[model samples]
Structure formats: C-alpha cells, structure tokens
Target: MSWIRSWKRLGLFALLGLVLSWAISCGSGTPPSTTGQQPSGKQEVEFWTMQLQPQFTDYFNQLIATFEKENPTLKVRWVDVPWADMERKILTAVSAKTAPDVVNLNPNFASQLAERNAWLNLDEKVTPEVRQLYLPNIWQANTLDGKSFGLPWYLTTRIAIYNTDLLKQAGVSKPPATYAELAQAAKQIKAKTGKYAFFVTFVPEDSGEVLESFVQMGVQLVNAEGKAAFNTPQGKAAFQYWVDLYKNGLLPKEALTEGHRYAIDLYQRGDTAILASGAEFLNTIATNAPTIAKVSASAPQITGETGKKNVAVMDLVIPKDTDVPDAALKFALFVTNDANQLSFAKAANVLPSTVKALQDSYFQTAPVNATPVEKARIVSAKQMQSAEVLIPAMKNMKQLQKSIYDNLQAAMLGQKTVDQAIADAAQEWDSRQ
Candidate 1:
C-alpha cells in the first residue's frame, strides 16, 4: 500500500513522469517575497497550494512574508501547482522524499495518501482546541482509522437552485425539500410546463452525485466491517427511484451520458426547473442568463430519509517525512486560522472551515443589495449547518464509485433490473476487498 503502488496501479505513472518533467523544466514557480529579511538557522519549508496563484498572489505573498517574520526559525517557500498536475506531482514528490512540508489537497486525494500512511497523523500534532475550531463533520472527513491527517481549509456545498417562476407556473409554491418531493415536482413541472424538471446524469463524472442521492435515501453503502452494504432493500429502492425517473421522462434523454455542465446549460436556458449546484454557479447564471437569474431562487439542497447535504472540502496536510513537521503544522495553522480563512473566503467567495469564521456576522447577515450570487452565499452558509461528505472517504474509492455508477447506468438504461444492479455493484465492491 505504498503511495506509489496504488497510484501506479490506477495508471498514474505516465502522469507522474509528466509532472517530473514539468517540475524539472520549470521549478515550482515560487513567488518572490516583498521583504528581504533572511533569518539565521531557518529551516526551508515548502508549502504547495493547488492552482491558487496570480489571483491570490498578493494575499499569499503577504501571508508567507508575515509567517516568515513571525517564525524566525522557519522559512516557507510557496509553490503554486496547477490543479490538473497535483495528484501526479504529489505522488512523485512523496515517493522521491521531496514532498512539501505542507500541501493543499481535496479529501479524496488526501485520504488516498493517508490510507498508505504517507501523511502525518495530525491528531498528535494539533491540540483538541485547534480541532474544535472547525465543523465536526468537516474535521472528521480528514480522519482515517481513528487518526486525523489533515486540517479542513475551505469548503463548498450544493444548494438546490431552481426557477421560482417555473415552480409557480406548475402550481408549486415552494421548492422541494426532500427527494420524493423533488421527483414529484419534476413530474408536475413537466406535465404543466413541458420543460424537463432536472437532469440526472449518470456518467463517470457524476457518479459521486448518484452515490450521494442513494446515501440520502438511507442506503448504508459500506457496512460496519467496511464491505459494501448497498445491496439491501433500501439501496434497491434508491436505484429504482432513478430508474422510474428516467422511465417516466422526468430526466433528460441525455441523462445517461451528459455531465454537470450540460445540466447547468439546461437550467440556464430554462429547459430544466431545478439545478443542484454550488453557490459559485450563481455568478455563471447571472453572467450567461440574466433572465434566468432574475427568476432563480435557492434553498438548502434537497435531502431524503436523512436531512444531511453533500459538501466538498479542501484541506492542508503535512507529509509524514517532512523534516520540519512542527514548523509546517504551525504555518498551516497560521494560514487556516479564523482571520486568514475569512480573508481568503471573502476573496474567493468560498466558505471557511473555521467555526468562528463561519459565525462572523458577515455570513450570518445577508447583504442589503443582495443579488442571486449574494443570496446563494447566504443560503449556502445556512446549508453548511448539516453538510457532510456524501460519498464516505475510503481506500479504493474510485473503484467503489465506478462500480456503483456502472451498475446504476445499466439499471437506468433498462439493461438490468434495479435489484440486479445493486447486487452486481455490491459484489464488485466486495471483490475489491
């Protein structure tokens, strides 16, 4: 279970080579510091963030300068890597023992490295007080085998963005609050307005969404022993729900193959009634479809038997072999503290992971001149109260997601029964163990 072994098995070796070439041709592109102060006996620590340069160059440069000033014995060199190159670059670096002291990563990639023990267990490095600063579920997302490996940084959660005018036209006064209601509204909206209610894409890119829906419906997914438990009656019912949606024309014909961008396009063009999306997309709507933005209203994303919603989080992790582990953890804490996180959030229009940052009146109170984008942020912040990672992080997560998605596609396209699909997916997951 070496870091390189699982990644190589997943066909990432060629990508790793490319990352090495790029790293050699162009060094990490470390930003120049404004201050010329050099500290004596300073341990040079590399800190990497995924594609956050140029836009936040000034902000990070200042932060790095301040951090260096404060920690006279530690020097942090900031590296901004492209998002597409992160996984390969990170694997290559860690394997070669040239990994950064602190690196920014999403939960899945961080979990993959954590599973192989490539990251330091932060539960030992950070105090309970520091851990308590973040939302419990978000903090829990970075834990594996009862040990925490990363600190929650920033997050985004899906909210149900729907055309209020369309709901009104269909005689529905409110957006759907639950999965059943979402499906019912879809049926009514289609029957009354003749526009599709929502697009249910089952392509590889959207498998996580499908998994989230199933979990929302009370599917256990993985059992207590970590084997697939989604073959149960509840799982079948969840699968059947989508099959029924497709069979009855509640979903678009391209649902089997399309991706989120296509779904967004449909919603923007008023071809769909509802679009489950992150708050950032509200700006896209306003820019691309002014008319639709005028009619768009958002609600906390729909839930099911359980009321939890899905969230995607970015976090900071310390490499297990870092020479300056203490300095790295301290610098990571400095960057993610309430003030810094809030500053970054305001700049990026993303949500902060720190509880105090989230509780700041800025998030609690909506802007006076609220546009759809502003409204989305206010609503999304509220939605964060119950948000958690939808697809539980696990080793071999990609395989598990694909297994469930492929079977779901077969069931949706009428190639297999719901029961058969669930059984086959469960079997595949079990075989992986």
Candidate 2:
C-alpha cells in the first residue's frame, strides 16, 4: 500500500492517451519477406516498459529479437520509460497518436484509463487459452467495470518477517499467529526486553494497510450504492485495536506518523521485533543488516478472521488506438508466457502471475542451503494460494482512502471519539459520491 503513491502519481497521465485515429492513420501497405524486416508499409508496434532500463535492457533486447524473428511481418519498437515520466510519456504519445501498441503498467493506472474507455478490452480480443494462463484473481486486477484491459505480470505478497533473537529475548518461542496473540506478545516483549514489540504504522499516505486490516476483520467498505458502510461495530473494534496499542505504549510512537520504510528501517537496525511486508524486502535486510538477517525468519502473512493475504501486482496494458492490435496482443502474451515469466521472476526475485510458472520447482521447492531471503520467497509463494489485491478497485478508491485515514488520524490524536471518527469518515465518503 505504501508503494501505491508512486503509481498514483502517474495515474493522472492515463487521460493523456486519448483517441488519435482522427489525427493520423496507421501505416499499412506492402509486403516484405526478410526474416526481421516488417513489410515495407507495415506499422511498427510500440512496446513500453516502465523503469526496466539499464539493468534489464539486455534481457528485453534478447526477447525482442526472438519475437521479431517469429513474426517477421511485425516490428516492435521497444521503449524504456522512467517511472516518474511514464504517465507523461504515455499520455503525450496518445494525444499525438504515437502511443505504444503495448505497455507495461500497474492495475491502478490501468483502471483510470479503462474508466475513460481508453484501452482495448482483452476479453473481446484474447482467446480462452491465453486467458487461462494467469491466476484468476490476478487476471481480474486488470478488469475495470467488467472489462479486462490488461495482462497479469509480476507480483509480490507480504508476509510476517520477525527477529528470532528479539522474540527469544521476550520468551516468545514462535511468532504470533493472530491479532490478539500479537498484542499479548507485544506487551510481554516490552515488559521484558524494553524494545518496541510492533511498528503500528499510521502514516496517511500508507494507511491503506490499516484499512486492509479492517477488511480482514470482515468490515465491508461500501454498500451496493457505493455509500460508505464501515461505520459499524466491526469497524469500531478494528480502530480500537490500534488505539489500545498506542495508548498503552506497546507500539512504536513513531508509528503515529511513520510508513513501511520506517518500520523496515527499525527492524534492520534491531530496534523492533516484527515487520509485515513484502518478501522482496528481505533482500534489503540482507544488505543493510547482516546481523539481523542471521536471526530472521519468515512466516505466512498474518491475517484476521478469513486467513487470506494481500498482494501487489504489476500488469501490461494496450491503449485504445493501435495499428496492430492482434500483433500487439501476440507479443504481450509472448512476454507473459510461462517460460518468459519464470525467467524474469528468477532474475528479479519476484513472483509470476502465470499458474504454470508458479508451479515450477523454482517457486515450489525450498533450497537446501536456504537463507532468510530464500525462506521468505518460499513462504510468500505458498501464501499466494489465498492472496489477492487487498483493496477493491473503484473509480474513487484514492478519495475513499484519504477520507478514512483523515478521520482515523483525528481519532488517534484525541480530536474525536471512535464513533465520531467513523461517522465523520462515512459522511465524507458519502459526500464524495
């Protein structure tokens, strides 16, 4: 959830890629027989990858070469865009009728474009065989208002990573499995060891995790008419859980304003005992605090009543106007195929969205000489069986999140009562509708 801000910053750019067919026409005409040459008048399909340059240039180049060889009549011009400039570049290209045929983007950004009818619906273009390749929940990430607009790419699921040494110091033999157990452990750890038991993050920018915690507790966020529905008993209990932790000094005071990075930094420096985060973060622990890495262990992500997990996914989408829709989709499928996905996952230490790729031994088997990082990968991949995007997609999702967190902050700071906070948040959400 903390990572969402980066993508949302680019979301406004979705409006940039509008219909350009009226301004200029696609290149289409003659035929060529050369192995790598497009027919003399064929339009080159543009492919854009986000911030994958410098490190992944070679990998992408090799894949592009192979693809061109197989489809000699089609030419794909690959472009690497910086993360900060992706929205601008894509939007500008679209406005000028120079948008890429295929582009790599996140679900949230794709959702924005889909809402504007600026993308091609894969359900109408791709075959059933191709549709069956991805994990069902992940494939749904690209669907906005019942239309599939993107293909699943790489993803990561968060899990509980704890300091075994710190737990041992507090006489905690195993990590807590439930919220109640976690609170009790925090109390015991603070009383015995004087170290913070948990970093209960409350930063407004990353408050979605707290919202997700409530969802895990069975709090429906919105009613059928899109009105706020979380001002209920379950919501009160969820908010009170954190309120109790903060007031009793069981949680880090910095948590009142900190984000995941701060919590991770505390764990790396041996100031905290637990961290609920993505498996990829283990690599940072390995690099920044080798000492903490030695005593670190991973477990399936902690959840509430349902025992499900949350995931962050990346996807590839096609703009509405493209000279080679079929050829573009063919290349998108090729890039996300099992073999290619597996190769990329291995190289990047990420999880693949394709079921076959996930079933591969690389994700299924634990290494004999496993380190904390390896342990995290195995645990995370296993948890993916029950994982899904934590927050449901909505046209006003960002606005809803801000409304909830603002009210939550007021309550946490004693500016309002829990009931009043929920009421206020619900009112704000309703007004937005």
Candidate 3:
C-alpha cells in the first residue's frame, strides 16, 4: 500500500493503515535539486509531489526538461513536500492563494477539498478522448458528484507476500487465495509455528485493510442515500470473522495497536506468514532481511467471495484559482502521459494508471529467470486488469473508517458482541449523517 507510495515511497503504503497511504501524507526528507525558479519571464507551473525527490531526481529532472522544451512559454518549478506536512502546508497555501499549479495527492486526501470545490474540474478541461487514456475505474476514483478533480497517476495494488518456510512448516503447499482458506491457514500456522499467519491492526485509526475486507466479503458499506449499509448478516459475519481470529489467537496480539509497518516487520522477521502489501516491498525485504527474502514468495492478495482487490493511487491535481490553468493542465497531462508514466513506473517500481502505459511489455512480461521481486511485479501488473479502489473517496471517508474500525475493535476486545458491534457501527455512521 505505502511504495512501498503508501506502500514504495514506503511512506504512503507503510502508512496504508498510515505507508500505503491512499498513507499519502507528506515526508520530511530532502527534495530533488530541481527547485527554485529563475527570472526567465516564463509563466511558472509550480509542481508539488509527496516526497518523490532525491530518489526520482534524475527522472523528474529529465521530465521537467522535456515539459519545458515542449511548452517553452511555461517553466516548471518542482517542489517535493514531506508526507506529514503536505495536508497542512497545502491547505495553508491554498488558503493564501499560493497553491502549486499542479499538485500530487490521493483521493482520500483531496476529497474534502473537492467537496469545497478547491480543485479544477477536469471534465471541463480534459476532452472525452483524452480522458479515455486512463483506466475508467481508476479515473472514477478521482471523481465526485460526476466531476473529475484530478488526473490518474501512479498506483499500487496489494499482493500476498508470504514466507514459504512458514507455510511449509504449517504443511500448506499453497498460499490461501480466499478468506476461508486464509482463516484455515491462519489456524494452521499458529498451531504449528506458534506465530500469527497475518497481522491486521484493529486500531480504528489504522489502515483500512479490515474495512476493505468487509467489502471483499460482500458487505456493502453504504446505501444509495449514503447511510450505513453494513449492519446486515454479512457485516456481522465479517465482524465475527476477525473477532474469532483474535479470540482464537490466530492473529498477533499487537494487531490491536500496531499498524502496517509493524505488520511488514512481523512478516520480514518470519513472525507473520503473510503480508498484504505492494510488490515494491520485496526490494525492502531483500535488503532488510535477506535470509527471509530468499524464502519469500508472492501470491495474489487474499480476497473474499467477491474477489475484489484494493488499489492505492497518487494523482495529480490543479487548484481552481491558479492563474495558469491551461499550463497547469498541460504539464499535469504531460507528466502522466503514457511514456512519462512508464518511465516513472520503471524507475520507481510502481504500476501505471494509464491503459497504454500498463500495456507496456515491461509490466506485461517477466523473464524466465526473474527474481521474486521481478515476478511479483509481473503478477501485480497483470492484476491491474481487475484491481480497483475498494474504498472510494468521500468527504467522510475517515469517519467511516473510524466508525467501523472502532466497533470492530470493540468486538475483538470482547467489549461488544458481533451483532451489537455491527448495529452500533451502522447507528454511529447514520447519526453522523
């Protein structure tokens, strides 16, 4: 989930409960040298990203050069923002009418601002033919009330990273492909290895993996009126599923408080058998735990009956009040065009959101001698055909996450019954409305 972006930038996905943003907060690192504008008298299209600098410096430096060469009248000033500082800083900048012309943000982070009409309407600017360049499902993730606010950028889809040793110890030849199989495997792993099969933090403020699970299990989170729709039998079953796991001790105790980072640590240390994370994390695993990396393997992420998968996207948006809408829009499109996106994806080891870019042979094929990381990339890219943002962007997304997570935690802690928890969560969600 963090690029490791919420999943690689590792900031956004690691934070996906926080890394894998969708964990798309700002970071506190040094930016690329491609900063500071000159008095060249060219209209500057200021660009901001969530800590993509230092690492992608050369790629961006070349990107800016190409965009400037293409649009000679418009100069580009790239500013890389920290993960935690982006929201506050950008909010302040937007308030002061000094927001960047093209900014990087995810759906969840920008939904509230979208409700306030703080962003430009891409539907009015991006032509129908141009809009088709992106995956329709991914493009819809950036829309609210039928208006597009951002251009689809890079994406990360969770994959099942498993420790083969752990699974072999538990006598399982294949990783669990469904929740039923996962539950069974969880029990087996714990019984045999005395280690949890997986770690999913129950902290209401944690990643939305559990909430996304509810959807995968065929639980509708909202109705046509936006009221809670998760108090049904399916919701109760989903709640009980986790409660049973916690109570049965199939999950790590730290799950109640820890987050995605902890989950990754556990997996890397061989304490948890599986990690629902982005493929780019394989690189981190190879570096931080080389021994474990040798035995690590990837499977398609575990799913419920619906067979749905979660995707995190980092998009490029423009402020409605910017003086250079055309310039900003042109730069945004240029940066996200097929060729540019493929280059960035290769350099960064993430997936592209564009239909054409994703079709590139790099993402579509893997050599026979591909390492685990390379194979994981091929699997993740192939999965792009079916993956989507399970939890959509809405003004109340955080609240929804909080309500469900809080009630689920209560159930896990024995403070509430499964039915009571489901009903209360629905009630809490409705009360807020």
Clashes of each: 0, 0, 52
Cα error, candidate 3, residue 379 (Å): 0.9
lDDT of 3 by residue, 1-433 (tens): 4221234335334433224221233343233222224477688888888766566678888899988897788898877676667888778877777787889998877877998899999999999999999998899989988899999998888899999999999998899999999999998998898988888877666577888889899999998788999988898899999999999888887888887678878988888899888787888889889998999999998989998887888899999988888988989999999999899888777789999999988987888889998999888887878788888776587788889888888888899988888888899999998
Local accuracy by lDDT, each model: 0.78, 0.75, 0.82
Residue by residue across 86-109, what tens digits does model 1's lDDT show? Answer: 888888888777788889887788
Model 2 segments more than 4 A misplaced: 1-42, 95-97
Least lDDT summed over 10 consecutive residues: which range in candidate 1?
A: 1-10
Q: How close is candidate 1 to the true structure, as a TM-score?
A: 0.90
Cα lDDT tens digits, model 2, 1-433, are 1234422221111111100011111322111112222558555777777666556678888998898898877777776665656776666666666677888887876687788787888999988888998999889878877899999987766678899999999999899877878889999899988998767566666536777777777788998788998989998888788777877888877876776557778899998898877666666678789898888888887778877677777788888777677888889999999999999887667789999999998788888987777778888789879888767767788888788777877777789888998899999999988
Once fitted onto the true fold, the runs of candidate 1 whose alpha carbons sit more than 4 angstroms away are: 1-40
RMSD of 3: 3.9
TM-score of each: 0.90, 0.89, 0.92
